[model samples]
Target: MSKNKKEKLNVVYSTNPNFSYEFEEEETPETLDPKNQLLYVLLDKKQRAGKEVTLIEGFIGSDEDLKDLGKLLKSKCGVGGTAKDGEIVIQGSFRDKVIELLTKEGYKTKRKGG
Candidate 1:
């Protein structure tokens, strides 16, 4: 007798006869080059509950990369924030410092919105 069990036809089993299982594959995030992308550094406080934040935009590629970069920036600035919608929001007006750091990291950094 074969010890190995045959592969299941469905990934999930349901008690209901009408139920069917469908599997969806998750996509891997793409890696992007820092040199090919232009990042914008802007200061914003319009809808942030009256707190100032530095916004980094125009990042191309994976959300994971964005989050990692956001973490790095937050640590460097000694603040807290979030990375979403392809933008990194740091909880402070660290525009100049952020630009400097990003430029040092080989990213094309730009200051936008005076």
Candidate 2:
């Protein structure tokens, strides 16, 4: 048996000659309209040596759409960041700017945390 087959759980061996493995696919949620999205912008300094990072959360959309939004924010802020796990993390403190940008894009944004 190949390493990949061995890694599959609950299937030691299939006696049936015509047996095939069935893999479940995850469905991505449809991207919501900008006006319908309620995004939260907040400043975080945890676990980064006291450096502040802006976190945008509460996004409801596909991964690709999330990534695209992240890219747009990074470019606008002229900073580096990442988008994953339904959150966007910008490298520095830019909460006001981020909220403004989101507003311009028709996304309902709220300031979160002091």
Candidate 3:
């Protein structure tokens, strides 16, 4: 292994004057495809300053794919929102439209909340 890539397991510091530990970085898991992912479209209006937002959740994929889906949804709805924490937030209450879009993309979608 390369020097930079190889990590040391030596102790960095000892607080109890007896033992110490080293922190190691963990490997990231691969992202799943949209077709294999289960998504949900729901209408949310809480804590939004009286504005309604459509939320798409249950996504298990990479950040790039999430951003791509967010961009597509925003463009199709002609609005703006954010995609983070495995959820896509679309501006306005476009639950039906969001479901339509997601279904067309070969994703399994379910509508939650009224």
Candidate 4:
């Protein structure tokens, strides 16, 4: 090989924002144990008014407070519901909306069933 034909190549590394892009990492998740209780979420129908209900199960809170929160949510949503069987029964098929609201309220949720 000729000396002139062989040339050394220089490599460069950069950290410029305009030159590099990255998908933002998810912020640290809330500290909640999803085990033991079996977190579950579902959309069901209320016996009365045929109102769609968002059912959240496997919660790990006191019965009184859980019921209180359920009542509060119903009032906020301008609907009617109840807390029973260690689950929060909210009137409305607000699957995504409830998840968003609960996450803000420090509840870890997992969507269950289709």
- Measured against the true structure, the TM-scores of the candidates, in listed sequence, are 0.76, 0.88, 0.76, 0.57
Candidate 1 residue-wise lDDT, 1-114, digit = tens: 232223334554568888764544446668678888899999998977988899999998888899999999999999999999899999888999999999988899889999
Taking all chains together, the TM-score of candidate 1 against the true structure is 0.76
Q: What tens digits encode model 3's per-residue C-alpha lDDT throughout 6-88? A: 46477444588666445466554567876888898899888999899999999886777888989999999999999998899
Q: Model 1: runs farther than 4 Å from truth?
A: 1-26
State each model's CA lDDT, in order.
Answer: 0.86, 0.93, 0.85, 0.67
- Worst 10 contiguous positions by lDDT, candidate 1: 1-10
Best by lDDT: 2
Over the stretch 1-114, how does candidate 2's per-residue lDDT look in tens digits?
Answer: 244654555767899999877544558899999999999999999899999999999999999999999999999999999999999999998999999999999999999997
Question: What is the alpha-carbon lDDT of model 1 when measured against the actual structure?
Answer: 0.86
* Candidate 2 C-alpha error for residue 91, in Å: 0.5
lDDT for predicted candidate 3 compared with the true structure: 0.85
What residue pairs clash in candidate 2, if any at all?
A: none
Worst 10 residues of 3 by lDDT: 1-10
Candidate 4, 1-114: lDDT as tens digits: 332312423324456656632333434323234333445778876465776778988776566666776876677677777897678887777778777776766667789878
Model 1 residue 31 lDDT score: 60
